[model samples]
Target: MSDQELFYLLALLKVDGVGDIMAKKLLTHCGNAESVFKAKLNQIAAIDGVGSSLLKKIHDKSIFEKANEELEFIKSNNINVSFFQDENYPDRLKHCIDSPVLIFSSGNINLKNRKLISIVGTRQITSYGSEFCKKLIEDLVPLDPVIVSGFAYGVDIAAHQFAVENNLQTIGVLAHGLNQIYPKMHKKYVAKMEENGGFMTEFWSTSSPDKENFVRRNRIVAGMTEATIVIESADKGGSLITANLANDYNRDVFAVPGRVTDKYSQGCNNLIKTQKANVLTSAADLIYILNWDVESKSKAVQKQLFVELEPEEQKVYDFLLKNGKEILDFIALQCDFPIYKISGILLNMELKGVIRPLPGKLFEAI
Candidate 1:
């Protein structure tokens, strides 16, 4: 976009009542941010949700001053700007209604035809969660997925580190502006992270890493990826919020199952119990569910040879094997497992590579 347009968009965002959704609607109605300012009061008010207060806010010239100052920071710092409608904007994120109208980024990041998955969880990550993140990324190296996270402590940082070690692109979506980093202790890793991947944020130079901004940041994490995996979480945390947003966006959600007694495992266990997330026992489960098709037959077969099934799962597998291809409900009925319970079993079986899902909710043993 032209400098003039960028200036106007920045100002539009600064308007009190205008947010991403409203900005998009106004942009759609008025053609551009420049035009939104030029449009008459009656014309602007015609659009739904464009209230008198908002129209008055649009007229306030102070927004322009703030926008101009931010523009200078962009020019001086060499910050890359991505208009939501631009080719450079993340494809999946553009589909989210609340995605930022403009994003500021710095790095050598590339997203062309790449698989994107988000790993999120508690800031107080445990050893189990750490190892899981490492192995998951290591096993996924062949696919070379772009790992996206909040750039915080625990699971987020671990995901980024694993991606970097594996030489895969990684992105750390920040809660604050690019001008500064939060959790000052993490500053040491910034240079290295920016070398291969980099940081992205919707906040402008003036914005701080406020508590509310982190919640807003979670939406971007969930929206911009094909799937979201919660490595570990307490009964309540921001990662669970990201998982919920992914579910809201109709994206796949996966949670690592842990023993019920583990404090950090409660959130994930509850997600699985509520059927909000698929049981993520291993990287293979993610690959199978997302249909990544990144594994070789030899590698897959090798793993399948060691696949151990629970007695209940074995019953379902044997039933599918004898029946050739059977509907989901029929398998549940034949196995004498409730439909809800059978779904999880089938998902686990699919993860084991013991069965493949067919069209019309059918399953056939491999």
Candidate 2:
């Protein structure tokens, strides 16, 4: 897109009642944002969702002034703008119907042919959540997946720090614009994060990190990644919202199981119980379900070669091998192990690298 086209797009986005969906619809019908403004009122009105009120808003001349202001900001800041149609945009996010019309980013960012996964959870992270998050990212180092998070406190910052320490790419999906960092305290991490991955946001320079903006920010974290992992969350929070958005996008969702007594585990436990997310005991669960190739990284999959299954574990493994995937109850019944004992047996099997767990209490052999 040219400067004139970007200017029109910026102006179009500023129009009242013209959101991402509406703007996309108008742009498609008219061929471009500039064309949308020049096209006949009758032609645009003929399109779905275009109303007399919206048409009147489209005629507002003040929109150009706002667009120009943002355009100038972009030019001066050296920020990179990615239109949804551009190849530089996130691949998975493009499939989402409500994805932003444009995403503004900074830093030496690259997403081509990379495996992207989001790690999100409660802002008040616990030792259990923190340790599990560390181990998960450490184990996934071989795959070189890009770690994405909201760049908030707790799991988001932990994921970024782990990724950076491991020399892996990491992206911070900001609730506000790239002009400033939220929480102010996180400014210390800006230099290192940008060195490896950097920050991205849909908001322009004029935007602020408001309460509602964080909710809107979650969708990008969920939409761009191939999968979402919730380390810990209470029964209600932004992490759960991100998981729901991931499910809505048909992307795989995973949650770490925690004791029912723990308040932060409630949201994750609920997701598993409702079959909205897979049980993420280890990184292997995500690797298996996503079919990420570990062949080239011999050390990563070498454990499976020497993995020795016990009698009960072997029985369950054989059943899964022959039957493909089976629920916990069915596996326990077929293997003649009691429900209480089978749970431990399955956990051992998972640790042995012989089998993995899935959503809905299903399990399968490696």
Which candidate number has the best TM-score? Answer: 2
Candidate 1 residue lDDT tens string, 1-366: 788989999999999989999999999999999999999999999999888889899999999999999999998999999999999899999999999999999989888888999999999999989988887787676667899999999999999888989998999999999999988988888888899889999999999999999999999999999999999999999999999999999999999999999999999999999999998865656776898763243355455456888999889887877879998778878889865467667765655667877765677988
Score every model by TM-score.
0.82, 0.83
Looking at candidate 1, the ten consecutive residues that score lowest on lDDT are 294-303
* Candidate 1 runs further than 4 Å off: 295-366
Candidate 1: residue 4 lDDT (0-100)? 94
- TM-score for candidate 2, please give it: 0.83
The local distance difference test score of model 1 is: 0.89
Estimate every model's Cα lDDT from 0 to 1: 0.89, 0.90
Per-residue error (Å), model 1, residue 51: 1.5
The CA lDDT at 78 in model 1 is: 91
